[model samples]
Target: MKAAVLYARNDIRVEEKAVPALEPHEILVKVKATGICGSDLPRVLGDAAHHYPIVLGHEFAGVVERIGFGVSKVKVGDRVAGVPLKPCFKCQDCLSGNYAQCKYYSFIGSRVDGSWAEYVAIPEINAIRFDDSIRFEEAAFVEPSAVALHALQHIRFEGGENVAVLGGGNIGLLALQWAKLLGAREVTVFDIDDDRLASASRLGADHTINAKHPDVEEQVKRMTDGKGFPVVLETAGSDVTMRQSFELAASKAKICFIGTPAGDITFSHKQFELMNRKEFTLTGSWMSYSAPFPGREWELTLHFLKQGKLNFKELIFRTFPLDEINEAFDLYRTPGAVKGKLMLLPG
Candidate 1:
């Protein structure tokens, strides 16, 4: 099998490697498609990887080639999407059905070899079978879709109120769609890029704002009649958008920060004071998971994809063959190089 092995910072090579063997509860998947995630950027370029000579990719889908002795949930030839989190089932958090909170969790792609190769072995429990009608590329998006859904679930969203999503990246776009699906009276997306904002509009966002504009807040105020959004989700890890979130929230609103911050953040007296004045319920969301292992986040993502309610195809910006993994990583180097998801065809 061939895998993209990262030997050092900014150094990734597609090389021959032995195929992974399955454990009793594991299954061998012939990886068909995988996606490059935002979290993968620093690990590949900033020396953030856990170790050297690692295979780094987690968002993926493939066909089952073989199942181990105890595998029963899925069978050979079943098309499935991979769940990357491997929580220690015995941990107190895991026992309490808070798998994402488990301190003893090992993530695929980041903590171990991931689906960046022709063949990868994963626990059967980590595989979510999808309808055959769904394309491998769409199935590959299940992980990110789940992440977007999980973020909104943190706010206990009941919809019918105005919602604001800060950022128009893949996750942000998905968040906007999920907000609409969950019954938001209106969903607005904010971003610095016009192309991304256009993508948001195509993905069913009721409104899109270019956050780069000096009067962006005024525009938002007009859109919401000055009350602001009752639900605010910040999916751009940028300090600018993170700071803007406080001002975007309505009084006593529910706000969730889903994007991971890349650097230290400091707020001014007036900026931080908004939270105190508004009395909003601010929360931070982690990786997608809940009570029953992989949880409803993963389940609902697949369901919506199968029903054609989710727009997975339009979110893909480009696709590269596994042999061109290095080139794919290079695309991220150029400012504003990618507008949406970048996919990899391992087969």
Candidate 2:
């Protein structure tokens, strides 16, 4: 087996490695398509300070080539997309259905070897069985789409509410689509790049704003009847956008921060005063929980894709073979690419 191993910053090599051995209750997936997320870039640059010599890819989907003992949820030849989080279910947070908060929570790609290879061994518990109708490229998106859904669920918006999503990257675009699916009357997406803003419009944003332009906040306020959006989601992970998020949200509105900012942020005292006066609810949402809930949002996202309600095919801007993983990373890190999601295909 061959895997793209990251040994240090800007040094990812495709090296031959022994195929991962499957553990009992685990399944071996023949990697088909894997998406490079924004987080992968920082880790690759050594900015995120992750362990070296790691296989980096969590947003992935593939065919089940083999199954471990007692793996009954899926069998050989089944198509699957999985939640990467593996948690100890006995922890207090896990027992309370907060799997993301579990002290022992860890994910593939970041902490462990991920899907940047010909094969990966995943616990059967994280795998979600899908039919052959779903393409591996589309199924590979289920992980990030699940993250978007989890953010939306954390906010708990009412029907017919307006939303402003800052950033037009993959997560922001997915958040726009999920907001519509959840019955948001209007979604306004903000991005500095015109191309990304255009992509966001195609994904289902009612309005698009270029944050680099003057009076952006005023423009957003006017679009929302001068009351500001009830829900403002920051997905850019920039300090500028994070600061502006508070200014664009209405009184008593809910703000969900989905992007991971790389460094500390500074805000005005007046912004906190407004939040207090408006009784605003500020929250941060991380990755999806592993524990089963009554309405699995990931399953719902799959259903939406299956029904043609959510179209993400256009979001895929480029695909590269696993051997060209470094080139793919270069393109991802470059500015003005406007590429939504880059897929690494492994055969």
Candidate 3:
């Protein structure tokens, strides 16, 4: 198998490696399509610490080629998408249906070798079978879609509520669409890049604001009749945008932090007090839950896609072969080039 292996900071190489052996409860998947996420950028740039000589990718969909002895959920020729987090079901957090919070949780593409290769072996429990109608390229979006769904579940918004999203990237765009689907009366997206803002407009955002504008806060306030947005989702992981999120939120509003800053942030204590005085709720949203049953956010995301309620196909900006993995990362680093999502196909 050929894979893009990360050896050091900005040192990824395409090399041949032995095919991964399947565990008793795991299944082997023939990699079809994988999406590059923002989280992968840190490891690619050598800023974030990660195990060297690792294959990186988690947002993916593929066909099952072989199954472990006990696998029953999927069989050969099945197309599937899955949650990357592998958790011990007996743990307290997992028992309580908070798998993301489980102490024994580890994710593929991060803690272990992942989808950047021709094949990967994942536990049968993590896989979700998709109908033949869903294309592999679109299936690659299931992971991010699940994250957007998780964030939506964490926040409380009323129908016809005004909402603002702070970024125009893949997650932000997905958030905007989900907001609309969930009955937001108006959706606004903010970004410094005009290209992304334009893409946001095409994807259901009622309005797009260039945060680079001098009166960005005032613009948001004016749109909301000076009351500010009832809900604000900060997806632009930057200190500047984080502070701006505080300024643009309405009193008694809810704000969800979906993006992480590259460094620490410092804000005035008075601003912290403002949140309390305004009775605002500030929440941090992580990845989707990995538990079973009714609140299965990942399952709901796939359902939405299957029903044509979530339009992921239009959001794909480009697709590259696995051999061009370095070029894919380079394109991802180039600002304003990717309008939505970029996929890597293992040909």
Candidate 4:
């Protein structure tokens, strides 16, 4: 087996490694297409990884090469996407069907060796079988797509109200589509990058706003006729976007924070008071998981992809072979050097 192992911050290397041994109910997948996630950047370049000498990649799709004892969900030769969350079923949160809140959780690509290799072993329950209509490249997006859907699910949105998505990056774009697909009257996407904004437009965003503009707030107010959006999704995790979420919500709105903050976040009094004044519900969403283990997020993602309702390929910016893993990480060294998704082809 071959893998891109992260020895330390900025020290990832492509090296030979032993193939993972499968346990009962586990499946060995021949890695096909794996997408680099935003969370992976910090682990490879910053001090966010839990351990050294790790193979990092969770968003992936592959073919089942072999199955362990007792595996029944998928058979050998099945095309599948991997679900990365492995929750302690004994935890109180897990017992309550809140898998995402499990006190003890082992995440692939973070807590263990993951899909950034020619072969990886995962639980049979984590192997989601997608329709053959869905390409391996498209199946690679199931993780992030499920993430965006999970954020929306936190609000229990039964749409029709105007929705605002405060980011045009990968997650934000997916959230925008989910908003529209789930029946939002209109969906608006905001970002500082024109390239991202343009993507939003192409993907059916009712409106796109450049947050870098001096009149961003004014434009937002004008578009909503001063009422602001009734549903706001903050997917940027930047201080600016997090604060703007407060400034952009309508009274009695529902707001979900999907993106994880990278540093200390300081909010102004006015921004903090908006929650009280507007009586808007503010919730923070964690990893995408719910009842029945991997849950509806992953299932519905594949459903939509199979139905051709979701845009998967459009979000991809580039792809690299596993041997060129070092060069791929170097692309992230320069801020904004890459846009959309960067896929790794292990085959």
Put down candidate 4 lDDT per residue, 178-218, tens digits, no spaces. Answer: 99899999999999999999999999999999988899878
lDDT of 4 at 220: 85
lDDT of 3 by residue, 93-171 (tens): 8898887787887789988999988898899887888989999999989888878878878885555898889998888
Q: Give the Å error, residue 281, model 1.
A: 0.7
TM-score of each: 0.99, 0.96, 0.96, 0.98
Candidate 4 regions with alpha-carbon error over 4 angstroms: none
Taken over the whole model, the C-alpha lDDT of each candidate is: 0.92, 0.86, 0.85, 0.92
1-347 per-residue lDDT for model 2 (tens digits): 99999888888999999998988999999999998888888888765736888998998899899999888989899898866777878889888888888799678888889999999889988788788778889999988888888898877766599899998988999999999988999999999889998888777789999989888867876787788888999998999888888888898899999999988998889876778887888999988653473127778878988988887797899989999988887775667763678999997
- By the TM-score metric, which is better: model 2 or model 4? 4
- All-Cα superposition RMSD per candidate: 0.8, 1.5, 1.6, 0.9
The true-versus-predicted C-alpha distance at residue 4 of model 1, in Å, is 0.2
Q: Residue pairs in steric clash, candidate 1?
A: none
Ranking 3 against 4 by TM-score, winner = 4
TM-score of 1: 0.99
